[model samples]
Target chain A: MTINFDNAATTFPKPVSVANAIFKAVKQYGGNAGRGGHKLTLLTSEKVFDTRQTAADFFGAQTENVIFTVNCTHALNFAIQGIMSNGGHIIISGIEHNSSARPVYALAKKKKCTFSIAEVSDDPDETVNNFRSLINHNTKAIVCTIAGNVTGQIMPYKEIGKLCQEKNICFIADGAQACGTLDIKMSDGINILCTAGHKGLYGPTGTGLLISDGKYHITPLIQGGTGSSSLNLEHPDILPDGMESGTLNVIGIIALKNGIEFVRDMGTAKIFKHEDKLCRQFINGLSDTRTIIYRSPGVEYVPIVSFNIPDMKPEDVAEKLDQQGFCLRAGLHCSPLAHYSMGTTDGTVRFAPSVFNNENQVESLVKTIKKIQKI
Target chain B: MNMTAVSMPSVTLAIKAKRMLNEQGFKCTVKRAANVSENGCTHMIVVNGAPEIVIAFLDKYNIAYGKLLGDAMPQ
Candidate 1:
């Protein structure tokens, strides 16, 4: 049987309930959310709205503050471009994914804002201190990820959030890699949290969330009908309706609720333990391999492992592994900044296993790599 | 089921209020206003149960709504 290891992109073999929910929604609850007075529309809207409350409860934010988007990147774009409209400065870490880095660079190219990347230190205090030292009067927002997507390095973002609270700067965290594995509380001083539903939340590909604390106003990325203010050409100022324009992905959102239910029922701790154990096993198995190189502290909550074989390109290993009936990702993983920081300029093979993946699969993966090394 | 109209300042607010009540076990639906008045919004929320229950609950939440009318909209 083939083993799938690229779960960081999107979890495979979704919980039965989530799959059933997507089908049920499309077949039964096929109606536009918040668009009509018909029974179907109202029922659909009610369920979707309940998902908002569920997501808010999950993210430690109020119901109204949670807004749905196409994906994590869309959420991040809304948070970044929404808050930084006036154009100022921001602080990011060396481990930022292009979701954050690319947007910041694009803004800078347009002369909208300027930013600085604080050095990532192994020591949490030093990393926090690096962020502290970089803060200036012009700093408008501090957009950082809860963990490095490529390295699984958990940055001490709460400390940075606390610093933002003290200085009144917006804290936007990309929770794509950490949301399901880690508990990101709003009390941690995160003004805005963006994440993908497929990565950790087990939702469909077209679903994501942007949970914000009702402190600052973020300009909507697009403007159109919100179903509420149909009579007026202007968009409603209320949240969800303000940020959410056009017909939302009702079927996807419905399935997302079921996905969150699966996570909630399975308990994130148990899922993390299972995936972490597999990651730890993989790391321990590779300890004796002198030619293998990988990122450290393998016992991380998120099960992402980045590594490469000496004198062999990552793509070659990935291709060979593919032939061996193992699916693994290779190359930059979309975060050139992360590769630069990890000193893997050429990139590395990334294996992100989901809760559905088991120890047997991990052993088979390690065995394949060892066999490949000898050839 | 016959329902009473709970009008709010805005249509979105009306929908939000409907969900709030529905979440509390009250069945509610969004309905276009019986008669389009210059001052009020075009939409209103129809909630089931006694008018007193709607008023007390709406007041408890500090959600403003006009007096309850029967299910039939005014011509």
Candidate 2:
């Protein structure tokens, strides 16, 4: 049996309901969303709208605040670009994925905008303080990833959110790696949240979402036929219609709706407890000889781990595990800056478990890693 | 000779250069060096051709990077 451990990238083997929803969407209600007055199109639009409501409730956000996108990258781009014009300053964390890093860096270069990167710390309080130190009068926004994609570290969001609120700085969160996996309260002070429907939410690829309290508005990255405002050449200046241009990924949206419902049925508390137990069990089984690298303390972490065997390249270890029918992500995982910060320039193998993973699979993974370590 | 210039921020510029070289039927390899000015890592592409033609394509696509001169080209 194939032991998949790359749930952080995208969760695989989705629940039966997710698949059923996608199939039903494609077979029965395949139509452009919010485009035509036809019955089928309206039905598709309603299904998509229902999904938005589900996401809003799941994350403790307002219904109209949620906007669908192609993926987490698209959602992040809309939020970052929309909030700041040229020549503005923003704050970001050191442990950000390329999706966040690249866009911010590009904007910094093109617009000559200044950005400060806060350091990552083991203590949650220190982490919050690091962010506070970086803030200044020119700092227009603060962007953070709820969980580090590289180390599975959870940041001090509650404190940071309150700080942003007190200072009136925009707080944007990249929730791609930590949506359904972690419980996020909207009242906690986060202004904008960008997430992936495919990751912890257990939906297929090509689905993402962005949530805002409507305090900050951004121009759409791509403006074209949104199927509304057919008469005007200019883009519609409204909530989702402004940002959501072109044909919607209808099938993916329907599947994501069902996926969110599945999470609701399971309950976020129960899901977190199950994943935490599994992760702690896996960490306990590792011997002292294994170097477990992570940041952030006390707060719960996503079910992910990055480690390296002494005197061996991470790629070689990953290849050996692949030969044994175990799937894992090797190398920097598209975040070289993160690797540089962790001092793992050679990169580390990342193993991320999910709700679909069983304890037996964890035991087998441990045994496989041990056998490979001997070699 | 039409001279076009493209300025890539980092990393992605290297990937774009390699891809463009391959598409135009040229062999290319990406090289890495520590950029002291940037205080971080920087990468450049070593391609076998006239620099002007490469620069034009890169400029059209708005790919950002710098030019290599003298011994900077990989042997």
Candidate 3:
């Protein structure tokens, strides 16, 4: 079997429970969720509701506050676009994923919204201070990525969240690479928590979440049938129902439920320990003279490491590794901001280990990297 | 009990108020505020109970709500 190290992009080989949960949901409850009152539909809706509650509890939120979306991008859009639907100012971190940056820039162009980027530093205090300095009266929200996907750099989002709280600015966190692997609490001044079910959470793709702490105004991105308030043509003025327009991804959501269960049972601390151990092992094994690792790890981060070889493109190294039967993601990893922040403008080869990865795989990857760099 | 209407500054708070009241065995229905119809924003939580009971729940939950306008129509 090929060694998979691209956990940051999308986790591979999801927990058996996740797969089984999807199978069960599809086999037993194939009816469309929130569409009707039939037994099948009710059963489907019940599972969906249970999953929604599970996600909310896991994220320290309320059941009514949790809304599932297509992926982290969609969730982020719901938080970013919805909050700044009209013209408003927002503060974003410089190392944010495109999921955080693109939407704001799009709104700036389309909705006349403005945003300021808060530069990051290895010191969490410095980062927090930067974010604080950037905040102003007009700043309605602060959209931050929990960690940089490319560099595995963790931001002091909690500290920044507190700043947002003191200023009454909404905190919209992009937990794509951090959720399920990191200890995230919504009470830490996080208003809207958006995360991907496929990455870190070990669920199938096409599933994501936006959990609120009952403290923010998020204008619905899409307004359509919410399976509630059918009498009124206008979208019902509620939380999840107001934001959730169309039918949700039921099967994927059920799988996400099982994924959250796995994470909860195994405990995020334990999973993170295992993944971080493997990451450090691989980091220590890189003896190649041509290899260069980026960003000094200071704060807590997920098990993602980005490194590069001199005079070689990130994609080229990834292609060579692919030839050797190892799956890894190289290039920008969809975060030009991260690359520009770390001065890895050409991008870097990223290795993100998951719970399924072991020492043998890390050894193989490290050895292969050394071998490739010597050529 | 005269059906009382409770207005909120935003939809999120209105939904929270509705949820908190329901958990306390209060039957509260949510509808858009009549004055803000043209904007299609802001909502009110309608409860058949006294406004004091509703305000107490909103305060207990730390959710902000306002007195329904004397002239505002109840849904």
Candidate 4:
């Protein structure tokens, strides 16, 4: 019984319906979406549109605002580069993933743009205040991650969005780690949201999305044939066509449609409660362990826990755990900036539980960790 | 290859100069002056083109001013 605990990176054993949907699409209507007038093409296009609508409704966004991308990195690049080119100040969290941080760093170096970084706080209110302190006259945008990919510390987005609203700064959220796990709404004041379909959405890789309120226009990153206005050399200046250029991964999108539906039927609130309960149980069982160094207490974080056993390297621990048939992620998890913020330069073993993970698996994980600590 | 000089005060100005040089079909590499304060990012552009053409391009774009680092003429 291998216990998989790396849900934050990419979900495993995706919902059966998600797999079935992909299989059916490949076996049946495997055609280019929105390209041809054929029945198969139209059917595939409808499925893609349905996926977009489901995502919009789930995230409280308008249908036209949703644009598909290859992954969260692409979506984030589109938003950051597009907004920064206009020349304005920007604010980002110190705990941002490299996908968001690298672009801002590169642009800030090139553009005469003033930028500020809001510090993360263990307390949600203080975090919001940290963000408020950084805003100034020329501030153009605020970029935040819905949750820290490393710490799983959920940001107070509603308050931050409201602040952005009052200050008239574009509010952008990197939802790669939080989209399907948390209940997000556009009416809560989110201006732009980016998500990876492979994570909590339980879809295959090669699928992502960027949804905006259409207030700020983003210039296309890659310009090529969008299948619309093929004769024109210039790119079409439209909502989706402006951003989505070239061929799309139709099979991945088809699978994501069913994945979103599976999440919708299960209800995010219920999923949250279940994962939280499992996390609490795991934490409670390991409360007595003196070797484990757990950070960020008294905050409502996701079901992701990062801890290191005293005198043991995270990678070695992960190797041992793998031998014990427990799959987990060790090291910086590609967010070295986040690890720096948490002062874990050596990295820590992270256990992120998903809805499919059960209490028995949690028990086995806790027990295995306890045994490993003693060795 | 001809070399041109432009004075860029802020990091933003330096970056803009670098981007413009790259976009205009010039092989450019951005370097930082040793004397400049390292408190923030900096960029120095070295390009291959007519000195007057490069200087004019920078001037037209309103990039910050700097002295030509060396004397060189396009072959």
Candidate 5:
């Protein structure tokens, strides 16, 4: 079987507990949460609350502040658009994924708001200063990715959060690539945090989280039945319920609780250590000078590394690697801004390690790449 | 039997109220609200404890509720 290394996109081979939880959820927890007061509905609602509480505790947020989304993109859309609804200035990092970029761009296109891109530098302070320089009187919020999806460069999110707090601007962080590997919390000055459950959390697809500190009111993106104030035509103002209209994804959510438990049991530091070791092995194992690794010396990164071979299309290299029983993501990875920022506009093959990957796999991948280079 | 029913805006808050009251030995259970107003239906946490004590607890926690209904008062 081919080893899976494209974990930055989504983790494969989910934890046994998560799989079991999914099975249990599909069989027993199928009732729509907060939809009715029946035993099944109430039981399911309680289970959903359990997951919400777990996420809240994990992120140091209140239980009501935890909102389940279909994916990280959905959460980013809710946060970015909600915060930008009043038509004001917003700042975003240069390395943001399309999730944050597209929503902000749409709002700007409709003339609902205006935005400025903050240039990220190898120096964390410089990155924060760039964001600060873009702030004006109308600056409402700053949307940033905790880590670059392609290059794995860890942004100064906490420092940026501090800047936002000092300036009274809302800080919205996309933690799709950082959550399970990095120790993050609402207390880290993040007013809002968006993340995917399928990635580092080891959950199944179609599960994400939007955690808030309850300091700001976000306009709901979709309004419908929330099982609260059923008589009124107007939507309920209650949290989580207000943001989470329609039926909740109980199966994905119950399974996500187990996924988070698995991450917690293993510990973020340990997971990072394991993945980072594999990344280091992959970087060090590549003895071929023709390999161009997209990384800087002083900057920190998650476990992802982007590389390209000279005079070769990244797609060709990825296909070659795939034939050799290895899986890696090639092309822009849906973050053209990241490629533009890293000066890799032509795209590159990304090697993203998960906790399941090991040094042997890294060694084999390096060997495969070396062989591919000769062609 | 004397009982106090505290109406909550949503099931989540009703559950929260039940958990908070039960943890303090208040012995409460959540049920669908008996009286639905024009505003809509909601959930209620029924507690067989002193109404003032229950009200005080909910107030202390700042848990939002719709109304306080009871079959009997301490007076």
Candidate 6:
């Protein structure tokens, strides 16, 4: 059996309950949710709302504020573009996934707005100051990642959130990597939080969430039949219905409900500990090898660990590992900005563990890495 | 029983209102409101209780709603 360590991209081997929920939802929920009030539609609608409530309660948000999307990219697009639609300056961290980077870049490219990049520093305080120094009169919002995807570097988002609050700037956080591992909430001074249900939450790939604290008015990215305000040409000015314009992925959403329940039952702390233990084990086992680990002593990170083998390409290394029955992601990991910031033009292999991984598997991977270094 | 239909902007809001009202021992059912042509499409919470009490509960929870469609409304 292949041991999967590429959980950062999309968790593999989802909980059995999540799979069961998918099977059940496919058979039972066959109606368009929120389209009507028939028994079939209502049943689907109730299930959709139940998942929304679960997500809201998990994230410390009101039920109405949870807007579902296809993935983290879609959520970030909605939040970034929605807030910047009126045109203003925005700041994004230097190490950002393309999901956040590309949209902000598109806005700047279209001359709709201008943006600045805050260089993330080793010290959390200096990183916050880097963002603080970029603020100006036209700075309408600050888009940052809760934890970067490439190297799993945890940014001091709360400090930046406080900075946004003090400056009256809207703080939008990309929580794709941190959601299931960290206890995040709107109370962290974040105006908006976007994340993938598939990553840390162990949900299906097509589910994402955009949560708001009900403060800023984000223009809708897409508008269509929301089953409300249908007679009017204009989109309804509401929390979720305003943002969610198309029919939702009901099957994926119901499965996501079960996924979130699994997370809640296991507890974020316990899950983090399990994954982190695997990371530590991997790091320790690779200590005697020639592999270069990307972690810094003073920086905080999630369970992901990026490393490079001396004089070898990341993809080649990943290929070798794959032959040994291991799964690891290689390349820029869809975060070119992060690669540039780290000066890794070719990228590095990422080892991301899930709660299902254990020390024995990590040891085998570590031994494989050592064997690869000798090749 | 004095019944009223409370118009909510969306089915989510309507369902939310119904859940809140039902939990408090008030009878509620969600149904698509009769098309108010000029006002557009929306949903309503049919409550088998005082309309004033229903409105008060909605207001307390910050739930948004439109004008009441009136008493003895079609469910």
DockQ of each: 0.25, 0.01, 0.07, 0.01, 0.63, 0.66
Stretches of candidate 3 exceeding 4 Å from the true structure: A297-299, B1-75
Query: Where is model 1 more than 4 Å wrong at Cα?
Result: A291-293, A297-301, B1-4, B7-16, B22-27, B32-43, B48-75
The TM-score obtained by chain A of candidate 5 when compared with the true chain A: 0.99
lDDT of 5 at A59: 90
Q: Model 4 residue A58 lDDT?
A: 85
Residue A358, model 1, lDDT: 88
Candidate 3, pairs of clashing residues: none
Determine which window of 10 residues in candidate 4 chain A has minimal summed lDDT.
A225-234
Residue A348 displacement (Å), model 2: 1.1
Residue pairs with backbone atoms closer than 3 Å in model 2 (clashes): B7-B64, B7-B65, B8-B64, B8-B65
lDDT of 4 at A196: 95
- Give each model's clash number: 0, 4, 0, 4, 0, 0
Could you tell me how far off, in angstroms, the CA of residue B70 lies in candidate 6 after the best superposition?
A: 1.3
lDDT values, one for every candidate: 0.82, 0.76, 0.82, 0.78, 0.89, 0.91
Best by DockQ: 6
lDDT of 2 by residue, A1-375 (tens): 788888888888798999999889889887677654456765666677778778888988755567889899999888888887645889889888888888889998887578888887878888889999988888888999998888878888878889999999999998877788777767778899999999888888999999887787776778887654445677755656677878889899889988888878887677777776777766776754464555345655677888887888989888888999888888998777788888998989898887888888888888888787662
Q: What are the per-residue Cα lDDT tens digits for candidate 6 across B1-75? A: 979887888777887888989999999998876475245667788898877988899999999888777642974
Q: Assess every candidate by TM-score.
A: 0.91, 0.81, 0.84, 0.81, 0.96, 0.98
Docking verdict class for candidate 1: acceptable
Q: Highest TM-score: which candidate?
A: 6
What lDDT would candidate 2 get against the real structure? Answer: 0.76
- TM-score: model 2 vs. ground truth: 0.81
Query: lDDT per residue, candidate 5, A76-169, as tens digits?
Result: 9999998887889999999999999989999999999999999999999999999999999999999999999989999999999999999999
Q: What share of the reference contacts survives in each candidate?
A: 0.06, 0.00, 0.00, 0.00, 0.62, 0.62
- Collision count of model 6: 0
